[model samples]
Target: MDFATWDDRVEKFRIPAIQYRALVESLQAENTIFNDDAKAFYQVDLVASLEMEPYQHQSEALAAWKLAGRQGVVVLPTAAGKTYLAQMAMQATPRTTLIVVPTLDLMHQWYAHLKAAFPDADVGLLGGGSRDKSSILVATYDSAAIHAETIGSMYALIIFDECHHLPTDFNRVIAEYAIAPYRLGLSATPERTDGKHADLNILIGKEVYRKRAEDLAGKALAEHEIVQIKVKLSQHERERYNKLMQIRNDFLRESKISLGSIQGWQHFVMASARSQAGRKAMLAHREAKEIALGTDGKIRILTDLLAEHYPDRILIFTADNNTVYKISNEFLIPAITHQTPVKERHEILTKFKEGEFKSLVASHVLNEGVDVPAARIAIILSGTGSVREYTQRLGRVLRKGQEANKQAILYEVVTEDTSEEGTSARRRNEPQRTQRTQSKEGEKKGDLKVVYGTGQKKTPRAAEQLGLWNDSGDTPNF
Candidate 1:
């Protein structure tokens, strides 16, 4: 018999919540009977409301999770029925579930879907002015992390959608404090730039199942093509770009700093604030990037692409809000940013999906979380060299449409003879390229890139000339 003095201050002997799972299993291994009175959650009788059959991928993903003890991450491309996968998991576990999402939009979206899936159960929201809690709860990451201490023990199952965001400094506490014996993490791209995604191994679980975009392209996802459109800066713009870059490069050379590695970037950031010359060089660097990324030639190409794909759904992505607003005003297209109101965002998405709006523009806000309309064309005006960002943007068009034979096109407008050339090459190194990893034995996989508007499937001369067609990782001549 296990016995301990009951501490009146704590009411009874207490253990860390995370150890609850191990303790119960240990007691069961010894064939000891114990009351599970500490558990506030109980098994539920939930079922998926949708009559649609589960996809092969979804079924297989859930099976893999079950094999992993109902605690692991599943990596699937966006629009691959991850929501349905979550529903299956809820039915499998049938316990009080807390579904945490990255955004308020997703929180509400989950609330609506789960409520529909279980019409009788109360679906509560924990963010955006909604604070109801029930057997099933949907919460924004902010709200969940803030209330983890109180609500962590209330749920037996926890599902983290877009779980990549859970590794942040403030968000990790939700996982650490939660006693949910069953946990699931869902993400299209879980790798974080800061390497914090590694924490997910301890917080949630290891990756149990992964299906890349390439893995499901023809069957589950729409077959798509990536086209690189290299645009050159004009003479005046080139002159200014060269001058600013020269200043920045000189400062880098004098400081023996390289912008190639994360450490080098950190060093440059630290050195930039220590001296007057360094500060000027930093300003010069910013101006040069603006000139390169916001070149007029890209705008011209975008205009032509918009005309070429007129009346078809299009998504225009930019690196900054200024560029998004500029394109939105110039082309009279709808714009979406984080600053957009909730109702406005909902209306814009509804209209875009219903064919009332032909195109939409956004900075980084549209890359994930909110459900964007399925678009046929995606034009990258400017963006960071993040593979996750690129994949999310590409996913906006990867959902198969009613036209079975329609092809999705992603146009990457790259500025030639500038830093963007290298940036473009790096963004294509996502796991979508045959799920390749950074190891010595694994051979690199080829990308599904095609030449732009050439009516040919081969690489175009412009992309070849700018070295944007290859992942050779050669240094660019500034």
Candidate 2:
């Protein structure tokens, strides 16, 4: 959609009418390149001189900043060089820069990327495990919230990475304390289903730029194939599942109760079990139901898929620590999670990059903000219908590399006829009117389909050397 269309929708969606008109009028009035005070000495030559060529869309985004006076959020997709845009904002200011990130992993990623892009300048990390002493500081929202007063008025510009998280009071406090005249917020999936878009708009900046997934597919990306593989419930588990369903349905029928209720939690308990003995039975029934759902069986099948797609770098993401541990141990893959020691996590990630390991399992630690671009394959073990998780996992494999037709395979294992399927559908179509064009057209068995990223970067030769694959095409011991 055009800028005018977006502005109209923003107003219709309860955006402050005055702010909407004012922002548009301001953009119309100032067609100048940019207006930062510190940018007087800034020149386009510096960007060209940095040994990086900006893509057409990247240049357009930069131009939008200049034309719009650089006062809005720029929503670039993951792997779309958001770091470059953040760097450009920093260079334009040429003063102290404070970048607020959502996680420690991303804090380090930004710190490392910034230092490499501008080797002559000092950069510091302010996350859990890093020191904080450079003019350009990378901090987690938790740190920013607590230390806002400490860094008060020292920065000329503030850049929020994964800025969608700022709706929380803790992170938003940093923006309130900051005196920086220039601000830029970046994210691949910026909208939350909870209707916090207005707070996100003001908390960061306006939505000044956006690009959908389908637009990049087959051009800057590969043609993706998504397949849904279905498995039947084991006989024993199926018997238990059918019995439990009958009991729950009977409760609903007798009570004239609907699942969709404002006070659903209490009703769910009453429906599932009416007494202490019944509760115990219901808990056992759930355990059996989960087993019948085929999550563990699906993981085994996924491992077989990896074996077939051997030597391919894979990232396995799950929301449950139990599942993360289970997959890592069952598949004998090196794993990293939030609980993993920092040094250990760093070492495993380095090994993954160096091609020493073929696959790694993780919890939500790698969900967003962090950059693990060497990963060409991803399997989503479990998560709520989070659009951010879906997009970020896709980004892990979308970065340009040597792997031709390298795919971002997301295996979402959901229990048939469960609430999980409904949640998955909701998230799959989360991106406003863009959903029609963003999604592929088809329906398969169950409710959720396996979503894969269609883009290939040739896998480096190192992937093979690391023992991720062999001539026999089997899972590697590493």
Candidate 3:
């Protein structure tokens, strides 16, 4: 085709310049009808073989993929149909693909999704519970790290799900060793508080596209109303908390522990909580007084919240198995943990989808790639210090519904004046790219928002409220 004809086609078809270049390179190398000039080598057929229908933003993403030579991150929100984008990429390339997931649940989810979309394609699942070996293989990071040398040499494409977790040594090693010519990393929240996400950018490719949560609230994602409900501690718990604090202070001072070192603080806390020899004296001092355990009250609060919001799907997250068991038993909600049997876990998830179960109490299991979008609400009883967990847990509830503008409710129950409060504050204050840019002079300052309540207001102040750094102006219900 002549330059005028090529230009006309490009404009008419919305084919990007880079895509035209790649296509022309392929066509000219095959000795198709063309001129020999360098400029003549820059145009080709403007056709896309993408099987799935692209979302509104997918065209923009396609341009980005073309611009970046199809090697970079695509940052779409949880329910923004990123999986569809990956499907399109697979269809466009028509190449053998290897999909790596962070967890077994996601490995299964991806396998099922790909199978449903491409029924005739040979799909495989390589994880703790699934059979392996197929053209489109879904494998866990742990499993891939061990066999990537053999598998990675063959696949033409490699797609990482929940790719934010790829920074770890095993996954990175596998990605680097993989011979796949095409790489795509998918994540709802790609940045990390520890500032290690730059490693992910390098491990996958440059960030080719990004669509933020606020940008898609009403357009591509469900609208969300974040609420914080606080419960007060009883008087009997107050006296015991005071004595426990005094003992913790004395033990820490005696042990000369430092919070600046994460490992040291972690070891110190574990010792204090679990070791009889290390902190038995401290517990003994508080044992004489009536101590209140928050698990029962927290479970009751969670069940009541579910009752209040019945018929809506809920995913409950907790940090410990004890908390998960308590919540599951008290509410009679099916629970999934690391210890849950694989067969039973699948059954629980299936029942949840059929509306046989309204809620699922899990210990950090549903935080990534589980495909539990029926959940309209999330209750975070406890979480790690990392901001990624907070984002992932929130993403679990942000998936779109048949009803547009679906409401997502996230309730965070934090212990006043405890490490939980500090962790929550740290999560909210972590900087984002837009927030950083908005801080410039002459720019509009972005509004600061918090998912959890500030522990400042209460009808009757509880004992734990005395030393709490609650700047949010709301009391946490015990």
Best by TM-score: 1
Query: For candidate 2, lDDT tens digit of each residue in 155-261?
Result: 65678888888777667778766655566778788786556656756655677766655455554543344444433455665677777767656655566666553
lDDT of 3 by residue, 223-256 (tens): 7756544343456665666667677666666777
TM-score of each predicted structure versus truth? 0.86, 0.72, 0.71
**Tens-digit lDDT track of model 1 for 1-478:** 2423457897977666765676787888899998886678877677667646877777778777776778889988887889989998887788889999998878877888888889877679999998887999999999999999999789988999999999999999898888788899999999988899999988888888787766667667787777776677889999999999999999999999999878998998899899999999999999999999999888888888888999899999999999989999998999999899978988999999999999999999988788887888999989999888998998888888686866888988877778887787788862222221232223212212235231333322221123212214322110
- Highest lDDT, which number? 1
Clashes counted in candidate 3 amount to 8
Candidate scoring better on TM-score of 1 and 2:
1
lDDT for model 2, please. Answer: 0.62
**Candidate 1 vs 3: which has more TM-score:** 1
Q: Alpha-carbon error at 453 in model 3, in Å? A: 12
Which one wins by TM-score: 2 or 3?
Answer: 2
**Residue 119 shift from truth in candidate 2, angstroms:** 2.9
Error of 2 at 143 (Å): 1.8
